[model samples]
Target: MLLNLPCTIAPRWRRLALMTLLLSGLGTSHVHAFVLDWSQVTWNTGSPSQTFSDVQGSGIDISISTTLAGGFYNTPTQDNNQNLNLFPDWYSNNGASSYIDVTIRFTRTVTNVSFSFEDMDRGNISGSRPTRYYWEDVIERANGWNGSSLVTPTATDVGSNILIDTTSRPGDVLYRGNTNLNWSPDGSFTLNWEQPVDTVSFRYSSGSRAQSNPAAQVIGISNISFHSAVPEAGTLWLGAFLLAALALRSIPRVPELLRIRTRSVSENS
Candidate 1:
């Protein structure tokens, strides 16, 4: 008849053995880690003299300034240096729109990407629903590259479908209503989006409503970046298993060496 081992002892030994196997596997498999590198870029637009630099690809920065119209008492001014104006219906009156476009390049493949826009401020210009912000992700078509026809994925604000609406007010932040829109005291806004696209192009429109005086415009971007996720748990486990197998193969000789040492010790005694 065989004697039974203690229940506590068996479980403890099994756990230790299992942990060793797991760690060995982790050491064998090669895993890649990704980090965002956003250290070269700059943007500035309009008055209040705003500027931004060293932006990441996954993030964005924005700036805005107001101006007074000429000869008219309290008439809105336009920032002519960057061709941007802050008054209502400015784009329509000037026959032009104020905007900025940034192109970002990627070397490796990225599956899922998250984007954030910062410093979207319209100031304290209270009026009937002034649409001052627009954001979208532009991707190149898989087919041939056309200078004019670049494929654009549909962008949704909050949960509502997004359209070129100039009637959106400062308080109205979401493209739909389900997304979070944070407003800062300095007249800035932040918006985030999650989309899987190969190439990303950011377009900003400021004074697109004016037709005649289309000089005043203001806009900026910063903190643009992207990162790849680490490998899943299965990958790590497989690595551990391979390492454990190697470890076991070397274990057979350990007992023999121990036995030889025991004999040598006895002989010396």
Candidate 2:
């Protein structure tokens, strides 16, 4: 009795088919998460020292002096000595200036972001009670990219007692969000951003309500999380093109493969 078998692909052909499948699966839906830290910061002059840098996986940098009048001090400390934190770094600002601005510049463009915040005073070390922290307004703003870096956005006080206002500044103001009231670190609050941003700035203490003494108020942040959206199909398209090119290059070898098969069949006969 004679038997017939269906045609089969060679090992190389099987590999090529697998590559095509993988290339098809590389869709544009991708996102990356980066936990903020002092190590990633490209520090400029007049920036604070690395005490905050001792906190691994989380940190924040504050400008000692800006075009505005206020200054900030940052140190690494856990909230109430608890595990819940946005980052280990905490800070306090004091000056005649109504608000203090903290800016975060990303190495990559980010479309979506979410971060947790606490407004308790570290001065109360018992961690059982909220300290004497007062605030009139808390605001956030984003600036567009000018090439690879963010353009310096202008920030003006909205009112007589207002702090830095990015809305009145030089660069394109892409997004804004704010909360009204005195913010303290007794608990945690998180902010999520829908607009894409290259740099993010947080305005603390608006409404002309600076600390009573401008020397007493303390503000603490636990951790910051950043999300980045992958660029549209450009990468996917490039991969698909490369795969198609490889498949075309293999076509010329197909005839050579058939000749070897034919020669094997003749020997069997």
Candidate 3:
């Protein structure tokens, strides 16, 4: 004698199959759900360097300066002298050789922030000129902060600030050379040792004079921008789909089995 399976099992199985399909589709879509909110600022100056405040609030500030050729003083022969003093009130230094101090003030507490820089100008030079620049964000941890204790991001390679090759043609946008800081996003990007901070400073120079011209000028940097990190809608949908699928999978088997048995008895009767 052959026993017939309950018809209710067919409907339950179809539901499970449908749920699996929907979940799979959702997961696939979620894999591509990522958003990047980036902004940039540029700075140039006729003086050795200049500083600007309220970059993130009013809008990113771009500073430009004239490139001084044949200024490479050491092993690096290519030196394009253009500096943007990120912190003029607090720190002072020679051009392109020392760290340019920057201050970040936050109204609220924050944890992480990312920064990117671009070489707006490069001196006309050739052959292995070491052009170096760096971006750093200093954080104030307590009151009456001294020096160096301020937390800063990893320094980029020298002559490669914002990681753009000045020797290369021009108009090259390089993101690798910039500094990226990870902290809570609830605070501002300003430097206020009493509070929190997320700021960026830059430095650049050529390696050799043979690789640059004393009168050569280098320039290029578009913008620097920032935004809060929020997951894409697809991510939310995928999460919901997975939750639904898991819930469906977790349904008590006993109830389903009982339903199937009742359906069978009713059909036979």
Pick the TM-score winner: 2
lDDT for each residue of candidate 3 in 1-269, tens digit (9 for 90 to 100): 01444343456567777777766655452111111122232333234433444444433332322222223211111123222222211121122332222333322223333332224222222234344222222221112112323444432322322333333324322222232222212111221122223333333332222221233222222122233223356766876877676667656488666766776687788
Per-residue lDDT tens digits for candidate 1, residues 105-220, read 34433333334333233332224334422222111111111233333333323212222342444322222111113222232222322333334554443332222333333332
Candidate 2 lDDT at 205 equals 40
Predicted structure with the largest lDDT when compared to the true one? 2
Better of 1 and 2 by TM-score: 2
lDDT, model 3: 0.33
In angstroms, the error of model 3 at 53 is: 14
Q: Rank all candidate structures by their lDDT, best first, as comma-separated numbers.
A: 2, 1, 3
| Candidate 2 residue-wise lDDT, 87-206, digit = tens | 111122322254455555555456555554454222222223234333333444433342455433343222222233446445433222223223433233445554566556555443
The C-alpha local distance difference test score for the whole of candidate 1 amounts to 0.34
lDDT of each: 0.34, 0.42, 0.33
Structural similarity to truth (TM-score) of each candidate: 0.34, 0.43, 0.30
